[model samples]
Target chain A: MESDRSHRASRRRFLGGVGAAVALLGSGRRAGAATPDPAITELPDWTRYLGEGVASRPYGRPSEFEAHVVRRNVAWLTASPESSVNFTPLHDLDGTITPNGLCFERHHSGVAEVDPAKHRLMVHGLVERPRVFTVADLKRFPGRANRVYFMECAANSGMEWRGAQLNGCQFTHGMVHNVMYTGVPLKAVLEACGLGPNASWLLAEGADAAAMTRSVPLAKALDDCLLAWAMNGEALRPEQGYPLRLVVPGWEGNMWIKWLRRIEVGDRPWHHREETAKYTDLMADGRARRFTFIMDAKSVVTNPSPQAPLVHKGTNLLSGLAWSGRGRVKRVDVTLDGGRNWRHARLDGPVLPLSLTRFYFPFNWNGRELLIQSRVIDETGYVQPTKQALRQVRGTSSIYHNNGIQTWHVHAGGETENVEIS
Target chain B: MSRFLSLAPALLVLVGVLALALPALGQTRGLGRPALPEEIKAWDIDLRPDGHGVPPGQGSVKEGEAIFLKQCAACHGEFGEGAGRWPVVAGRESLVNENPEKTVGSYWPHVTTVFDYVRRTMPFGNAQSLTDGEVYALTAFLLHMNDLVKEDFVLASDTIAAVALPNAGGFYDDDRETTEKHFWGTEPCMKNCKAEVTILNRARALDVTPDDKGAPKVE
Candidate 1:
């Protein structure tokens, strides 16, 4: 009886509030009619006219006001736009999946506009029977699979290894994107070539001006790699290797050659320019580490970062992205007092192996200073290391695969800046 | 008929599964036509470290210099010292120790990479346009600029493999699987993981980080 009475009382109170609001609006309109009215109470011009109807915008687009949400490139990072990278707008995005358009782009030469009709995939060298596959031929293969995976440049947070260099997470950690790929397993296609005993390596080459190529261990080629033609249920954008691209899960983005055209099976690694001269990690001891494929577990708090700072003091949702090339992210811990104390963050979305995962932690701020950070632990039980810990081994020279912890110093005035805590 | 034939295998497998009988191995489904010998030769441009696929060509250092100036000098500099932020193709003899300057001369293991990379992607705008002889000439020019070969040297397919890099022995296979094996531990410390912590540095101190134009307005 008491519960019913309380429910009735709440309904009556809500109705009373609505009645009072209507009365106030009526009185204000009547009073305004007597004076020179300045408010926008009259029907607008848009309401007076019939707007453009169905099929007006057959293809949808974001509102004109949201023009700022775009992939950005740093002017001084490279000599020209052709050989540079554009960072994804991670600060403007929520959830795990990155839209196909907003995904980061890294090109060695320039984006190739390939004609699918003319494009052909040649599988030759060290095979029982070499085969040539047109686009239609590739589509006819069985065991077509769709999977969501994250692709990260080995140099994602490389600049911050020396110190907290980039201000925003978009620049520091935005060289990564997660998307659902519709593709055929590379193993299935390689099987058609009839692998020989000496075929230990597979060289994937692109058709762009660069003709960018990388050698993959035959074991990895036959494991979980893919020849993807579509991303997020749409044909790949021209910038993203239109007809096809190699999707080597859990490996550096360079190995995932785009605009894929050929695959040559060989007995040994090619040790090409990308693997030797570029992607190799330089150590303090003067020795460089080559073929370091796996990207370790890493995480960064996207919000409460330099780009997305706290606007008000009260309830704030601390959200970020955590991922690992090895497997699914098992746990993410957020620290408020630097590294002294940490709280287990709630995993927000589906946690798939080798895919980006979102995590969130809600907290009420009293407008005090805070040093925010996040640490990720993957399925392999590998904990994300501190910047100091990584530097002890790498010594600040190794550029690629710097999965160190990131810190954001949040001030009492609702501003945050990238900082390093030792 | 083709659809029915494909479905017959699945139906047989289903019946075999219910009867606990081992299903017959399916035949390899061949879809595409056999690759022609000319098609294979056309796309097989990769040159291995052991000098397997180097085409029959000869290029002199004198001829290479002219090609370098015409084709590669814009990005790589006339003397291979590099222009602006492009790769410094020459010099940096002993700098890999202290503050490393990893140029082609100081680093890079095999010389086959130079030949393959130049032929596959060079002149920046127009790739795969260089003739085999021109690629040999460019390789010889880079070798001369690196102080490894004399000015009169002619680089050919047979002579390329013997030319070793200075830092050929300076590399090692990835040992992270063993070196960083200790990093994996299931139970990580949560509260009071460290006794004390201090802010050692800020990214803004160096004035390097880009301006946060997208920062939310502070109240």
Candidate 2:
């Protein structure tokens, strides 16, 4: 409601103030790329400190050299950008930290360009004391937590349900990313509202044009849900909900509403469209499956993936990422020449609960056309299966939960293409 | 020496090109100038559920009806029945699990969310253009159409705090904490995982749709 011009100016200044310490001249533009003009003298200090500043970017971003890290959409999937999804570039880097800018995106009515200044998080359901927290007030709450978790869309591997639909990891396992969240625990804030004894469920709604809404179990909300204020150590980027978003670890990403503000606790799940019409899985029994909240374990190889081609016939360090919505990835097994032989991979980085776990497979290549694949084992003992293994059970008619082993065909020329074994 | 001298111009140009190309090739860090005082004062309009940052204003159902008809009815429909694929504004309750028809009246958990949504993004094209009074009025009218409120029931910045949403009781705060039960090595058993666990027949547990619609779902 505070629409003063000064307020808008202040927002601009905050961005301008982001530590652009190592301006590095043309760093604002693409790296190693030529700047249009060469005749200009020295630039200003602010401009000199152009790129993200030191200690400023508490959470680091991908190097400018890795500009290809992005979310890509399958044009054949849907027509509109607002109604469809674009996956993250899962094959581009090492480590579990997903840069805020490179995280994958799925939109209902498109990302709502909601202004944090006008946004408000309302909690007014089955509560004894109803209260609204200003962005500052929410920050003032006592409980704060820093946790790492991988957010996988329920539809991350949806393509493999039928067959290998896409070749690149960007399209295969790109619908998910892991990041560190900084925020107040949902319980701490809910307690301030004084929940009624009957409050057993929570309906989360977004401030987007779609007004995306979903019903979450009260047990889950008070369990691990975080009203996240920061991603990867920095205030969220606008695309990732600049002010705040709901972070539900180890669950489907859709339930993690961005630009979040409302939490109404009740005794029953509000069968919103997301749970009933859209997100639900249609079973072979002609019954529309619903309440499929948890996202299962899944993994894939990023490097030596489609876009990352083999430069030569030598020893290459092949690595990929594995994660589980149930818990930590137990181990990742890699097959260099198809499943004829399987070898264990080294799982690295912070192997936190329900977060992305990076796995590496060191192999010697002899320049022959080979079939490469990786399988993940979760703490729940769930093993990611092959595309054929998956479709044999759950027919290809589902669009929701698809956790299958993905295969990449490597050629003598070192080019990888998406393929099926059986 | 003469070759180096003759190629100096081009060499300098090449160095500049590399400098332009690799922006981070040579860089040092330092905090630049301080931001102006005005920068910190923005974004103070965030509204909390416990009632903070709410502006002053009030509107009646009669005043809001016109606003709704002119601004909302086009997309929401003349009677707010939600004519097309657009979401239905009212009617829905007990329709969730079994043959459910989700609607604002039946499924929305909190009425405050209606106001929160409108104030944040509404009317599709011209979002955030409505006055606080108009927002209150439209909120009341939408509820009225859902049969939750009387035809004359009015909503205002002050009165909105009291309207309880039907779906409000359908939600809860998430709080999952410990992960040791699900993660962490049990006995550092890196070798022979097969000995520790016996494999029974593996049955398919889930079936996901790969395409859009009418595809046969088998599991």
Candidate 3:
């Protein structure tokens, strides 16, 4: 890795020398101002040597050169490694969808390795024919739903609730992942059991040691929830609930129970430990806001962030992600002078509802210091609020649901840092 | 409105439509068999604030303290004050100012949540190993430590709901749909959105963010 870094440094030095020569040749009329000829147009090592055969890596992985792209966790964030969260490298990823391997992981009692043969999903309580479904039995049901959705932890930017705390988008906006899930509709499974008239809530429980449970309203369970077994075109990675999981669209990620084992139909919410003691957002006045499920619209500048610094002064493509738990991101605006001026950024690729939407803005840089920010408006006409605006209402007491607009300060030396501008 | 009205021209046709949909409402295709009694008993372990699913057993505060020393003291500390970030459970009485210390005595809305959580995921590594009697005793001990009950108090399924938490009224239902309604709008200010913007805070100034090269240890 060190050698690769040095090689990249030399290549940059070579490019700088060649560009300087070309500029001198184009502008000067004096002698000895001509650009040098090409150094060596010879074949590299690959051209003379035999390459490795195809099956050398039957299941291929990323090349060694890209080793730096990885999920990272702050050691000081939690006490134990078992019950904590690791952030996704959002600044390193491109496009809207997060790759399965790079998705951020959060576990309360560590990941559970369950045998699919022994796993059973028991649906009881207010139902006509309460049933237990094995992995195979669940696949036999109809009305399979495949859709792309962004799952965000309610505490994605929780650390920054007081002020700008994390230096990179990977830490500020990384506790989220957008993926395509293939599963049967949760409504179909509930219908098979015959939901009772008074059934207004469903308690989804995990099989992990924590047995993490969350009470979901029945209206949402019937709306867009899924009994997902596959994600990103393959079986769910163990870190993200293997065998079966509940996909609660637009709700807080905790409600999307992983390693799902049982769901009980009930007339009222269970008010479990998760919903009351943990996920609830405390207000400034001492009273907490309970069951705040939807993650509001949020956006951030990816490139020229703390990690992905600007390296050149010419035209540069600034890209970032915008998403909403309410609906699709309709428009994204980029601000260069700390919200003093703004311009519409182009939305790239598919703009599906409740999914991550990519936005880009092209700008010619002259190595001047600037404050960059991005604001998103979702389909429901909800405008992303500033940190000041959110703080006025929620206060710094909350450690969850901090979806305030993020600011990145770009220095003249071509480095960036996280900052808050008022 | 006309498109939908044109389709339903007659009352007889509406009646016929209703007849077809009514049968489909309660119909079950019998794809999966009925859940056996034993299977339901195994997974139906959720308890509610109303004391719905607490197992029948009794445990005194004295019994709970003995069990806590053996099973939980390694992590929760001798007095439930918590050991090395392992969640403090008692004696947060005076820390309820600006930066509140949210312990079981001052924060949890429901005691049933405590009972249910401990019964299902307690002792950290050894979960669901505590008997019904032990869980009741632990509940009794926690209540005693919080001063909600006497040292000789005993907790059981029938009387769990009668015990109230100190901060039971500390929470309210979500009102974001109304409280934050002003955030929803058709147009937001673009040009001249702010004037004389100044930097309020910087992560670099705080210097808490870790180095980017720290590799995550995945289990």
Candidate 4:
């Protein structure tokens, strides 16, 4: 009886607070009579009507209001859609995990639609037993594991190497995505067919028309590699190599062959067109750097950026993403004055190895111009370098592996633009 | 003795269950069957720099020119100079320029890459449709266009390796750990990192970024 009395007292207090707010609104309206907010006074249509029943959409979709959140592509970036890329809308997302449908797509000859039953993964060359396994056969193998990893294209920030080119982070840094994958460890599969003594490298080939191929060291293949078929608790999307794909953790996205068809063990690397003509980092001295696999520590402020501008004047929350291919992110630093001073930003959510980490910094804005930036330090104590520092050594020619600090200039009127601070 | 006799029945049942489960676990270990030689041949198409997987075929520059015009010239241009935004396959621009034109003659290191790329994924949408001889012909024509071979040169599986291009020694293994690591100090500057900051460039000035309507803002 005493607890019920206290609850009634709290209810009365809440009602009194609402009545006082209305009375204040009435007194303020004496200057110029204003219409009351319909949203606050009248019930919305949903309150008076019955909504759709369960499973209206067999697979649930995002609310219609969120239709603008989507993958975007730069039409002039490449020649054709078949051999092009589309970026994830990073500014529209939250947390560390990128939704499966929103993951960035990089295609050589477009998405291949393969029937799982007819598709096969052939393991040959430098193996005791050359095996061909169907999709069902792979599932029966023991020691299945689920892991979250970020796959980044080597040329993620290629355009920004010279200067700030892309306005939105979606175009500048969206050639990446992180997802939880369910699959068997590659070590288990390779062990099933015993490796030959001479095996030191392996070639991963895709089943798409491009038949994309990349040679990987056997030591890495035996390490944290996976043969994944499911992502985010569902079967892989066709655009992301539906039946199966190779997951070379902590390496360039090109090494992760989609629609994986074959694995050939060898004693040396195959320098394909991707490794030679493309993906190589060209130096100012006219020499190119080959086999630069690991993506270094990098971070970017998603909010107060070009697309997502700071509108509120009193208080605001700044958020962004940071990650490293080598390991977990140890700390993230934010700068509001373009590197004059740095403050530690709170790293939120689980900081998994080779996965995206979310970070936030709360600040009170006073309607002043601000230059915003973020930097990440990985577990290995590697610090994200400044754009000038990277250019001092590597030059502006290299189109791949540009992990430099990005600066966003926020105006007093709440408009933000991508800028390079010197 | 009476207590031991009561537990014997339970122990016997446990032993029976282990015997039945052991074989099923063994079966799971060996999941896939051994692939036949024919199946390997159908998919093993990748080639190495040493010409390890080069198929036995030969094509002359004359024959290659015909195939290039009919099959590949629509996008690659009549003389492989690139049409519209397609890749220019024959030029050799300076590497240190503001915008380097890296073509087959200027950038590619291996001759086998030409053969492998064409056979595997060239003709854009109609990939792997070319016969092995036609791919060799296309490779020969590309070499001729790059001025690496004579018009009468014939590229065969055995002869392709002998042909070498410039910039073969232009690439080195990644040395960022040694060359660029010193720039990344353990303790980055927190206060007074720079005396003053000025905006050097703005993305809006270029106006090349795509608009929200998904159209190029080039105009």
Candidate 5:
């Protein structure tokens, strides 16, 4: 008890010292020569006292200092919040795997808070035997596998189709997240029900208010698809569809139906609203492209972006993320002077197929302006195209699948801004 | 002869065990029960483009206009022009323009999509609240507003597919493999790709992005 009182007294003294330093700095006086650095000289309150016990936070959360690291949404992007999207804070995150709570959310209606006890998944239509499995029943099934994959919304950089629109990377290229999913193979589940010989496509439906539906090819479902119930070693978050969700590997994120409730095998594709009216890409020649599922190779520099600008003058680390739907990212090329010159970035961690790969480039910054960019080459040997190259082929009419290289112009004063370089 | 006869019983036991395990391995683990027909019917609300799963109902444009004014007019404008940021459902603007207005009449390839999407999820919040007859009416009214149907025209499951949208021929299957694959070269440029880099556009100048203070308050 005596130690606790002394700790409180020391904290008060520390806070008072901080206030005095702030006042001295605010008065435009040079306090560095007159007073020593308190951060190094004086002991902090955290060091003097014992921290909280393990039981304090039953589950756990990021540090209070990291409260700013959160999912953010552009308010005017959609009509209502229920049917809108919130972006992942890529600039603030490190490593390849995204935290469960910080994953971007794109919902048609709203996040459905489903009760695991009452939730049921129905497999019907052209199957030999239509079956219904509850959440508990799904868990008991055999052949559960864990796999890491990246889910990128088809519209990750859609707003930039016209040009550089949003300032921050969070808004520009943040509609993606990488996570380890634990679930049963969709093929095993389909084989259990016995698929019909003529079944070609299957409609995966969600239980949200929108009843989101998308037709997925049967071939894709049989290979690499999963009925995932957990992500990042924990139960799926409510926004990510609790209890169960469909994981369509290497495909557009929209097809990964959340709050998954039904799978109906059919002979042909169901041209649902999502496939036709929305996800379809419109061309400048008055034509549209349907069933464009695969998200091509893309990369973006997270640090030194608009949100996280360069702050130091020397010995800084440039970090970014690269991913491809086709396969593993073979290499990531970084350019400090726009696209005039490029260098191979070092892939730091695990490089798995259909997963985000973290890369870093250490360089010395001498307070000069820079036009930074990164490009990715997937295992398929397909190189990421420039924005102009993409616009020439796709035109400015597309709202999805804009995997063009992004440029960040850093000012001499260490602030960065989103810009398009010619 | 005595040794051979003694081993026959052990071989028979092993064969019997194999026979029992093979069938179990071939079949499914058998975890869930068969879905009853009634349960399937309750949840099977999706509709295809060929009018396969559409329910039997009929509604006229006049009936749909009344339902739209009351339930949908608050968001979707009275004349289907759209209220606020809601989608405009009546426009037939040209797609080959700087800012094309992709409405039901301009971009939707098939009329069945109108009926299927409306029947499955419509009116935004109160989805699946509309009856089959109301859905048919609402679809007919939207078609009338888009000038695809006369004011007195009636819409039903049998006739829905015949009402072809104007952009029916404007859509094609994804051909990116041929159209855009050539752009992705085997070896990307490494040095001096551009003689000089010039800034063409800046996001800060547009200033349309939502600021930090205006973070979404979605529940």
Candidate 6:
């Protein structure tokens, strides 16, 4: 059967080309070889209506496919790429702000541009009022509020206490974020500068060319602090400090000093080499801790983890992210089998004050091989440890508090591999 | 910041890995490319040390002593000596944590951060396009090459805050209390984490290491 007569003569030339496209659809011709209306292949009913100018947004970004949510680092640590710092993706992000182009940067003298209407913020020396303002005079002063927090980066787990290293959480847990912020409360601009009851330390400083300075404490600058100018709402996005900065929520984000400028109020604590010898911690008894601050209570599960995987396998979710500079996160758990049996996890939104909450968990993979891990806790009940209980309590001569608990294996065909279960 | 990862329950969870590089939504990606602005317009510059964001151009010290003897005294030796070996912009004063090396009018600490670092990086072979009177006569001949001021003195932006930096009050601001209540509780473990689950006994088990300095250093 000569190949079944060439498949019945190519099925009668495809049914004689479908009967000349049904006699060219009533003979007006233009039917098959005319495949060119694809500029949109569909959708143009006023672009499926969501218009009427959909409530304006003169500016605000993210969702151009998240442009890879940027700010990364670890170029062989650093020798100079105009001083360094770049960490901010926090597992593809979710909920609590952090979007001004993904936040986390830190430069020492490079990214300044500084023009916010010729910027100013100059508070100057021993004040009774040595003013300068503008960024619209500190957004026209007045309580302002918004809050939410978590800043972190006193070297968030400076490369594990000797383990897991980097394999992505965008370089492990991406520095830190959690946003909300807006501005002004630095105790009503240091009580409008006139509180000299022997001042006791203020020195802020930062106009950048490495003019970076610090030295706050006067009771956390009269508690809560935030000369900010807005984030998650607008304005301040010249790399998170356009016309002012100094939020200090949950501590350590280079003591929150970006493009800001001068403050003074002094009495002591100036030692600045970014706190003598780069964010000091070097211990193991050779002595070196200096004001460790506090960001503690950690957590991490981020989808299957190594950059996420496992797609279709009976219901799953297992999200993550938690925070703690001292308050919210009350409970996170996770442990798919690492700390041997554990669960809980829901959390989600407003876990406010020094922010970042999120958490989730649902599970049911069945493809086998997992291990996960999370932990957190917080609301003044700090939990997150393991890395063999933080190097058996801080020993391996520290390198800025490593926070700990983070694992994720997952195999069974979905991949992902950062491992550390013991 | 944020380097500790660990991950192992077979392979560290970060599932589905779309690799977040977002920025692409529906189509048409072909226009011979070069408009670049569907958004991104922030542009920061930072320049403090007191002159804050300085970008208007003003340098002096008599046109910065003829462009610091024509682009910084032959590799900075006509007085910034330390040449052939470079650096040595004059001896670092008290040498703060008394170092072993480094000088720029004695361990820098603000003179508007040496005119915002020679108006944005000095003649390290051209940077930020200097010239505010040759960065104020090479910051008044490096303040007479560190004896601080007077070679007939002359730095400008109206005297760069009467120049007084010697680690302008060194620095500090972390006031530690790390959210007390013992850094927010936990660590109780409901019951003996099995006497802290003993581990001891690894003796090196590394991989992926390649920090490439010469491409070799193993166990």
Candidate chain B TM-scores, in order: 0.79, 0.59, 0.78, 0.83, 0.82, 0.23
The 10 consecutive residues of candidate 4 chain B with the worst lDDT sum are: B210-219
Give me the displacement of residue A310 in model 4, in angstroms: 0.9
C-alpha TM-scores of all predictions: 0.87, 0.62, 0.88, 0.90, 0.90, 0.29
Query: Which one wins on DockQ?
Result: 4
Give the Cα error of residue A117 in candidate 5, in Å.
0.9
lDDT of 4 by residue, A1-422 (tens): 33335434533432343344334433543334377766668999899999999968889999998896889776666667788898888888999889999999999999999999889999999998899988788898768899999999998988787788777788788888999999998888888788999999999999998999998899999999999999998999999998999999879999999999999999898899888998888899998999898888889888867667765666899999999988999999999998999999999999999999999999988878999999999988889988999999999888899899999888876667789999
Count of backbone clashes, every candidate in sequence:
0, 47, 0, 0, 0, 73
lDDT tens string, model 5, A1-422? Answer: 33335434533432343344334323543444577767779999999999999999998999997887889776566777888898999999999999999999999888999999889999999999899998777788768999999999998888888787776788889999999999998998898899998999999999999899999999999999999999999999999989899999999999999999999999999888898878888887978999999999999999978777776667899999999999999999999998899999999899999999999999999989999999999988889998999988878877889999999998876667789999
Sorting all predicted structures by lDDT, with the top scorer first, yields: 5, 4, 3, 1, 2, 6
Candidate 2 lDDT over A1-422, as tens digits, reads: 12234324533332232222113222443434575544355576757677655887786666676665566665435434566777787777678888777788887667767677777777766876555565666776657899998888888776555555455678767888888999988887777677899999888877676666777888888898999889888888777766889998888888999888666677776555566445665443333446767777777888887667565465789889888877888889887665666789999877877888898888888878777778888877767765665545445545667877667777676666566664
Arranged by DockQ, best first? 4, 5, 1, 3, 6, 2
lDDT by residue for model 5 (B144-175), tens: 99998899999998888778899888889989
Cα displacement (angstroms), candidate 1, residue A393, comes to 0.9
Model 1: runs farther than 4 Å from truth? A1-52, B1-28, B95-99, B209-219
Q: List runs of model 4 lying over 4 Å from the truth.
A: A1-35, B1-28, B183-185, B207-219
| Candidate 5 docking DockQ | 0.44
- Best lDDT among the predictions, by candidate number: 5
* Candidate 3 stretches greater than 4 Å from native: A1-40, B1-30, B93-98, B207-219
Query: What is the C-alpha lDDT profile of model 1 across A141-248, one tens digit per residue?
Result: 878989999999998887776787666788788999999999989898888778999899989999999899999999999999999999999888878888988999
DockQ of each: 0.36, 0.03, 0.35, 0.45, 0.44, 0.03
RMSD of each: 11.7, 17.6, 8.4, 10.5, 8.1, 29.1
The models' CA-based lDDT, in order, is 0.83, 0.66, 0.83, 0.85, 0.86, 0.60
